[model samples]
Target: MRMVKVEASVSLRRDLDTGTEMQRDAVDNIITQVIEQGDHALYTLTKTLDGAELDQLRVTEAEMEAAYAQMDEELIGALREAMTNIRDFHQRQLRQSWLTTKEDGTILGQQITALDSVGVYVPGGKAAYPSSIMMNVIPAQVAGVKRIVMVSPPQADGSLPAGVLVTASELGVEEIYKVGGAQAVAALAYGTESITPVDKITGPGNIYVALAKRAVFGKVDIDMIAGPSEIVVLADETGDPGYIAADLLSQAEHDERASAVLVTTSNELAEQVSVEVEKQLALLPRKDIAAASIRDYGVIYVARDIAEAIHVVNELAPEHLELLTKEPMNLVGKIRHAGAIFVGSYSSEPVGDYFAGPNHVLPTNGTARFSSPLNVDDFIKKSSIIAYSKEALEANGSKISALARLEGLEAHARAIDIRLEGNK
Candidate 1:
């Protein structure tokens, strides 16, 4: 890891992936094919892209039973426990419909309602991310969203992973489909014979999936375009070098583009952590990937003082921030940006990723500056309520007309005038 002096300005904001021309053209072609050919395009694309010849798109009851059988008792118990924690956490975020009555007989409020349907795109490849299934699906379920669909690419044998299947089944996600990539996104955006269109699509995918989501934005709502994982550990002289190094490596192993940074007030601790990171990097199973990440994007910034370190952290606005300082709690209120803050040496990054109750799908690539984590709010919509009484309108009609006419909107002014005249 490279060591650098904290400058007046510092940042780790990577440019979002705006797919290459070829990729965008390919995604456009895929979307057009799905819209024109419907289920036929899904079948053909699944064979070409995933090399799987499938007779059925939907997972059957027998498949679900088999998925459950393949899982061990211990793993099932762990998943159930995680589910309970996640459900409980999101239940607190649920909003209620509220209205207020004014003295002039006017009712104004906001109505909270769940989306009619939602589609969750679970990526399929080298690993099965059952945790993602829980993070994305549980919130929608908690938000009272009906008809949640799950889609993922199938294996060469035309079978989805047992862990993925079991996780979806455990979450009560009945509408499971074996389709992925831009085609699956298209099917969710525009209905096919087999899969109905959903009101919104939420999940992470490859570049193609990201572009597909971009293309279908106005047609249906989507979660933000996520970037690579990032972590920043802010520590002082009292911080443990080994614990900080271990936490940094946890994020570095994620991908070659992932960033892990340490900003500390102690120059001694920075050097020690740099050494520890190199020592531990050799023992990791994904040593090549982690090595490349640490070589390219990892860094340790030596700040002049604790205040300078916090200022640098805010400027970076990392996706995951860990405070390993002596007074970690006191500094939390000063942190203006960061997707999630892990306090002390014990709260490692992975703790939030898998077992922790909070949703792991957080804002990345410096988006934490303005964005937020995935929650129940993403799966629901809010509508403003207004019931104008005769008294309320009579009292304010001329002012409304004057304001409308000020904007050169005669029809708006006339609408108010007509109501006032009829009442008079």
Candidate 2:
């Protein structure tokens, strides 16, 4: 990991601008082709990028059943437990339509409705993310989404991952497709013969997937254009170097583009952590990927004090912020931007990523400054409802007509005029 002196101007905006513009253009091309060519384009892109021959794009019932039967009892039990916790967390976020009436018989309320259908994209091939299956589907399920369709790239044998199938089945997601990447996104955005278009698509994926989601934003709602996984640890003298090193590596191992940074007031702890990272990197199976991530994006910044460290953290707006100081809670109030805050040494990033109740699918590339983590709220819409009795209309009609006329909307004024005339 590189040691950089913490600068006052360093902020999340700086980090957001790090990716190459050429990558963005390449992603745009995928989106253009997917939109124009539809299913045929999806198949061609899949074969070219995934290096997998494709015949059928959707998963069969037999495969789902076989996957359920193949899974071990222990693994099934664990998935069931995680599902329950996730369900409970999201269930608390569910809201109902409400109405209120006044003495004049005026009624107003907000009607909360779940989405009709949703699509979840899970990465396949070398990266089979069953955790993503749980994170994306559970909220939609909790929000009462009627149809939850899933898309993933198929294996060379054109088979869905057993773990993915098992997870989807457990979550009651009946519609699973084997298509993935930008093409699968296209299929979800616009209906193909084999796949139904969804109201919204949510999940994490490669740059192509992110760019595809950006392209199809108006066509379908997306959670966010998530970038690589990231973690920023704010520690003090009391924080453990070993624990800090372990937490940093947890995110770095995700991918070569992933970032793990440390901002500390103590230089002694920084040196200890720098050494500990090297020692721990040797034991990791993904050492090469983690090392590359560390070499490129990782940093240890020595701050003048904890306040400066906190300032830097807020500016960064990291996806996962770990506060490892003596009084983590005291600093919590100071944190203005972060996808999720892990308060103490025990509250590591992985805990939230896997077993913890909070959603792991979070805003990346400093998007936490304005965006949010995926939640049950993402799957529901709110509609405002208003009704007025004749007496109530008589009371407010003049003001309504005046305001509408002032805005040069004569039709709106005429509508109110008609109501008033009926009352007279």
Candidate 3:
């Protein structure tokens, strides 16, 4: 990490402009094939990419039970604890159908309903994230999603990761599939012979999986098209370099494309954090990946003041924003963009990613400017409710018809016109 003191305008543009067209095109191609050819295309792609030969894609009950028995008690307990916290948080986000009636006999409100079935795609191969399983499934369960189906690729031994299986079992997810990548996405998007098509799909994977979700968006509802994870640390002279360095590396270790940026007012803190990152990188198991991420996408910008740092963060609209200033709370009102905000030194990004009672599936690559973190709202739909008595319609029908005719929607006008004439 190199430390460079630049004005806020330049730093903002540079950080916000990190977009990749090549990656988008690659993901689009995979989605097109999955939609065009369906299961046959999925099978060929899975074999070519995952290097696994599969006769069946869905994981049997026998496999899930074996996975539960294989795991140690201590790890199982930890997963359960994480699930409890996640469930408790998402439970608060649940919305019930509501209605309101006016004195004139006009009734209006919204009916909130959970999806009948939802699919959660867990990454397979070296990236077996059980944390992701808990994050994706718990919210849907809280929102009363009828059935939750999970999918991940198999290991070389043809078994799913112990943690993945254990988490699924703990969360009451019986529909686990061995399929992965764009093919698994296809199975979830369009019902295959074995796997049942879900009403919606939510989870994270590589570019292929993301593209598949984008392609099948209309066919089945999906969570956001997630890009690489990123973290922006806004610190001052009071911030600890060690803590800042660790938090930045936490996201960088996710992938080579993952970004970690430190924007600070103090030159000394910036330089100290750079050294701390180097020292900490040497101790991490995924040092090569972290190092590559830091070398390519990581940046440390020294601003003239704390206000400048905040300005840069707002423009970038980072997925994760960590405020490590002397008074982190004071800066809360200043933030207008960020999928999730972590205040103070103790509130690190990982806390929310795992144990904290908040959704970790956040918007990435500057999408936070317009998007939000996943929550119960993502798993449910809202329909507006409207009812009007004859008197209420008689009072407002002519205005409605006038507005409709002004827009040249004669049918809409006549619909109201018919109601008014009938009442008269």
Instruction: Go through the candidates in order and give each one's C-alpha lDDT.
Output: 0.93, 0.87, 0.85
lDDT of 1 by residue, 1-424 (tens): 9889966344677788898999999999999999999999999999999999999999999999998899998999999999999999999999999999999999999999999999999999667999999999999999999889999999988889999999998899999999999999999999899999999999999999999999999999998898888999999999999999999999999888889999999999999999999999999999999999899889899999989999899989999999999889999999999999999878998888888789989898888889889999999999999999999999999999999999999999999999999987
Encode model 2's per-residue lDDT on 316-355: one tens digit a residue: 8999999999999999999998999999989988888777
Superposed Cα deviation of residue 401, candidate 3 (Å) = 1.4
Query: Candidate 1, which ten residues in sequence have the lowest lDDT sum?
Result: 6-15
The TM-score between candidate 3 and the true structure equals 0.92
Give the lDDT of residue 333 in candidate 3.
Answer: 95
TM-scores vs. true structure, each candidate: 0.98, 0.92, 0.92
**Cα RMSDs, all models:** 1.0, 2.4, 2.7
Worst 10 residues of 3 by lDDT: 10-19
Residue pairs in clash, model 2: none
Question: Where is model 2 poorest over a 10-residue stretch in terms of lDDT?
Answer: 10-19
- Whole-model lDDT, model 3: 0.85
Model 1, TM vs. native: 0.98
In candidate 2 the C-alpha lDDT for residue 204 amounts to 81
